[model samples]
Target: MSGEMTQGCPPTPEARAAQRARTLARPGLEAVRVKGRLRANKWLLLRRITQLGILALFLAGPWFGWWIVKGNLSSSLTLGVLPLTDPYLLAQSLAAGHVPYKDALLGGAIVLAFYLLFGGRLFCAWVCPVNLVTDAAAWLRRRLGIKGGKTPSAWTRYWLLGFTLVASAATGSIAWEWVNPVSMLHRGLIFGFGLAWGIVLAVFLYDLLFASRGWCGHVCPVGAFYGLLGKTALIRVTADQRRACDDCMDCFAVCPEPQVIRPALKAVGQAHPLILDKDCTSCGRCIDVCGKDVFRLTTRFDRSES
Candidate 1:
């Protein structure tokens, strides 16, 4: 007791100022200046436009009766001609002992073919409305000087994906839909906002206050399913210009799946500079944030470092 300090003292002014300075050193600031603000944020702007445009297509039918698309993201018919369905939902229906209609089978096949050709996580980056919510939370957390809280195991989502399928089989129902925030949000938008707002808000707070990239990165089973599908995707982000990199780490900071970048960007002796990780969302944030333009979206077949 005698060795311990008698009273807790507040941090000195200099210490407080130093903390502020450290927080102000946000990533991509240098890149913004060097690359020009608009050029630096090019991919981010495209992603926002894509997300909002998809939302508009869905909303126009329900809100204005334009009827461009006739359902939510889980299942939809465009112009009463093009049918699209979530393959994961189709799988759940099968596990629940239900034979989907021929149209549903065709829709699922169409979606599967698209993802197999491109990248499955493209859904997460380009279409999922929930991505906007999670991204806002991540931005706020960075601004507020938030540090580590709870880091869940990356494998948790795969386990949850397995559990959802098993539960569907055992209960004869699509068990995950009851708690799926994506469906809830879409339904709320078309009908009326209710519990969907609460669910979305909870996800935002969870990421901002408790964990970094928690929901999308660690807990979403939907993302896990798509990740598995993307294992052999033809399109990918390559670090072919990695030799020009100045080790900014800005790409790592902005990347939702930062672990995927290291092998490609830092592979000194490796033959390829392609990011082959299935978890890589192909979001193009690295391309936007890198001053040296180290990353680019290209075919997986391109292996040349040039």
Candidate 2:
């Protein structure tokens, strides 16, 4: 009687799995299709806008003279786009016997503006060529399932900061322009070929194939500088505390700047809602990926308050 009863019941596990599969398959497919379409549209728009901007730059490049130009703008008197040009300007300033800091350009208004609006990430997103190259490298790494470890502790960026200041002092602010990857790439594109050209082309290609923007977290001196200044910025990436945050570090995993994210996650508490690390670039990547809606770019300085 028992054997017969078991046979009549059959396999409940198999039956239950079949039902579950049917329930999940359609919803999953629909979600994929919707996501695909949105991504396609966004890509199309970005392509068109970038093409127009590049055309404008190409036309403007010759007029401005990428090497250097004699202008009357005082601080930016020598208008050019090449990395070495800044060095030249610094040399010129020294030759003319001008002291540093006594006449430092206070034109960091744009940088400050972005900090006020979105934290220290304005320069990361808008300027900095190294950021661009690293972003591309990250994209390539991701598409290929490439995982990179954190930078060596010995290679801390504060050394680079000191170097820039010393160089700028010696060369008349040319140090900032010299190491700038933006100026480096622009100069290479305009006047270099062979090895130099190959380097730039490879960076661009890698970005096309990978996560593209992940490299910024690993390197980028200018980004580091802004990040330090960013602590006092009006806008910042922070997490909300009202939600149940079981050690589920989803926010940290998705963050491009994990150095900043990890500390913030560990320090989050009932009283403090946001992660306010000096290393935070305020990229907002964390906010986009948090499932619990416990993350946001907020205006408050208190990182504990979300």
Best by TM-score: 1
> How accurate locally, in lDDT, is each candidate?
0.86, 0.46
lDDT by residue (1-306, candidate 2, tens digit) is 011124336536555455334322221222224345443234224433553344335435455655243221113322443111122233434544565342232323333454545656544544344444564455455445544443434245556655666666666545655445555565554455345556556545544443334235534555566666567667665665535433334344435566666544556333465666656655554454343445666765664543
Q: How does candidate 1 score on lDDT?
A: 0.86
Q: What is the lDDT of residue 179 in candidate 2?
A: 44
Model 1 TM-score?
0.91
Clashing pairs for predicted structure model 1, backbone only: none
For model 2, the superposed segments whose C-alpha errors exceed 4 Å read 1-106, 109-118, 148-150, 170-173, 186-215, 241-250, 268-271, 301-306
Say which candidate scores most in lDDT: 1
**After best superposition, candidate 2 residue 201: deviation in angstroms?**
6.1
Task: Show the lowest summed lDDT stretch of 10 residues, model 1.
Answer: 1-10
Off by over 4 Å in 1: 1-25, 268-270
Lowest summed lDDT across 10 adjacent residues in model 2 is found at 23-32
